[model samples]
Target: MRKIYVIGIGAGDPDHLTLQAAKAIGRTNVFFLIDKGEAKQSLVDLRERIIRAYSHPHKRIVEGRDPDRDRTPADYTGTIADWRHRRSQVFEELISEHLREDEIGAFLVWGDPSLYDSTIAILDEILERGEATFEYEVIPGISSVSALAAKHRVGLNRVGQPFQITTGRRLAEGWPEGVDDVVVMLDAQQAFTAHPEAEIYWGAYVSTEDELLASGRVADVAEEIVKTRAEARERHGWIMDTYLLRRRPTTDD
Candidate 1:
């Protein structure tokens, strides 16, 4: 059977690769890469470094052009569904054309595959379509959630409080019903600014050479983060950032 390994390579740093993920890289015959474009080529470069240092010379690299989607759209679910369909089509084609029945293929993902990343969802679409017959396994790597917490030297949760993980879009809708400790990812707007009373631990380009980190009461640091984010985005042509927001525990306990 043709086998596929969807490996998580971590957030922006080659060193974030787990040994298990590296071993999977060495075993893969064809590595399928989704090119997200030149602006975010720093990510592709990190993946390349890991692949170069570990994979055997006989291994191959296959590039799949990532389909573009509206970053902010009124029809969020519809936009994503259409985009995922296109991505599944591209991935299915790549797997069918280059992956032989007995050989293995791999997709190196940023952070953990189970996070906000879409490779797993796209692969599920490919499977449901029955265009490619392959066995696959997921290798989890350190997610930005963990990296962010580490960089900020803080735990995700307070004493007995639970933590919430969500996207900036969800955050804009207002805080989740019952959580005071929240980790927000893919937040272009620094949504934490809306809840300035909360303390925030924010980081950008995490674990990379251009890494930037800030922590303080949201009201105190929100403007600085916005400015830093703009400057970093202009300098690198892209930005990947996440933040944790923690408020005083309420009686919901």
Candidate 2:
């Protein structure tokens, strides 16, 4: 039977690769990657660095074109479902055409496969379709959530309080009910301002050479963050950021 390994390469930094992740890469017979286009060459280069640092010199590397999706779809949920299915088809074709029986192929995910990444979902769909058969394992790696908090030297959760992790779209509706601590990821719009009273610890390109950090009351640092974020994104063609927002700790607590 063919085998696959879904390995997290970590956020924007080759050094974030764990020993287990390295070992998994070293043992891979083939490394499968999604070509995210030229705008994200930095992402590709970082993935290359990981392979160079570990894998066998002659090991095979396969690149599959990542499916493109409509950024402004009329039906968001429907569009996402269609996009995911498209991606599953692409992955299935890659495995069926390129990977051989008994050979181990691996996909290097951006962060932990179990997080917001879609590799696991696509792979599961491929298996479910029965067009191919393969065994796979998930090797966890450090996520931007961890890297962001680490860079800021802040804890994700406050004492005796539960935190929520959500996206910018959901946050735009309003602050989560009864949640004092919230970690927002994939927020390009700077929605942290919704709670002006909150303190935010934000990081971009975390753990990488272009790392940027900002922490202060949202009202104080929001504009700076927006400016910095825009500059970074316009300069690099993309950005991966995460933030932890907490209702400012008061002496009364």
Candidate 3:
């Protein structure tokens, strides 16, 4: 039997790599890094830099490409299912080719794998289909939300108050009801505009050398965020950003 370690690399910063994560990298016999095409080269480069910094002498690096999805399709769920299946296939192929008995293979995930990442899920699906079998372990890392909160010097949730974490798509479709604070990620649509009345603490390229930080009333800064995000994405060729929104308390409430 083989062992597979799914380690979180944190949010784009080398410093965020936990000691355990570094140790995992060193111990693993094979490392698999996913490439999502040129639009996300920064991610690939960051992973490579981390591997070079911490990997053991004998560890093999295997680069894998995730399959592209057809965005023209009207069926969103179907598209995602197909994409996931393709991604699983790619990973399964890599694991089959490189996995050795009693040797550990690892995948370095961005941020925490337990968060929005689907890598573990896809791997599980492959196992369910009986395509692969390996003992798996997930090592958590500091999430973007934690980094964002630290940068802003604000608690994610008020004392005794609950908060929610959601994607940009959900914010755009409809703001979740009754949440005081919401952490939003994967925001390509400038979803802050949907919640014009909330206060926002936004950061782009967070924890990186070229980080951009902005905070203000959402309505007041939505346009600025849109413009800044566009410029940053163009300048850097890639950007990974996260933000927090707090619905301001009304005088009546």
Give RMSD to native, each candidate.
Answer: 1.1, 1.6, 1.8
**Could you tell me every candidate's TM-score relative to the true structure?**
0.97, 0.96, 0.94
Give lDDT per model, in order. 0.90, 0.87, 0.88
Best by TM-score: 1
* Residue 144 local lDDT, model 2: 91
Q: Which model is ahead, 1 or 3, in terms of lDDT?
A: 1
Off by over 4 Å in 1: none
Clashes of each: 0, 0, 0
Clashes of 2: 0
lDDT of 2 by residue, 76-164 (tens): 79999899999898888888888888888999888788888888888888888887999999999899998888888888887777789
1 or 3, which is superior by TM-score? 1
Q: Is candidate 2 or candidate 3 better by TM-score?
A: 2
The TM-score ranking, best first, is 1, 2, 3
Candidate 2 ranges with C-alpha deviation above 4 Å: 249-253
Query: Candidate 3 versus the native: TM-score?
Result: 0.94
Q: What is the lDDT of residue 55 in candidate 3?
A: 84
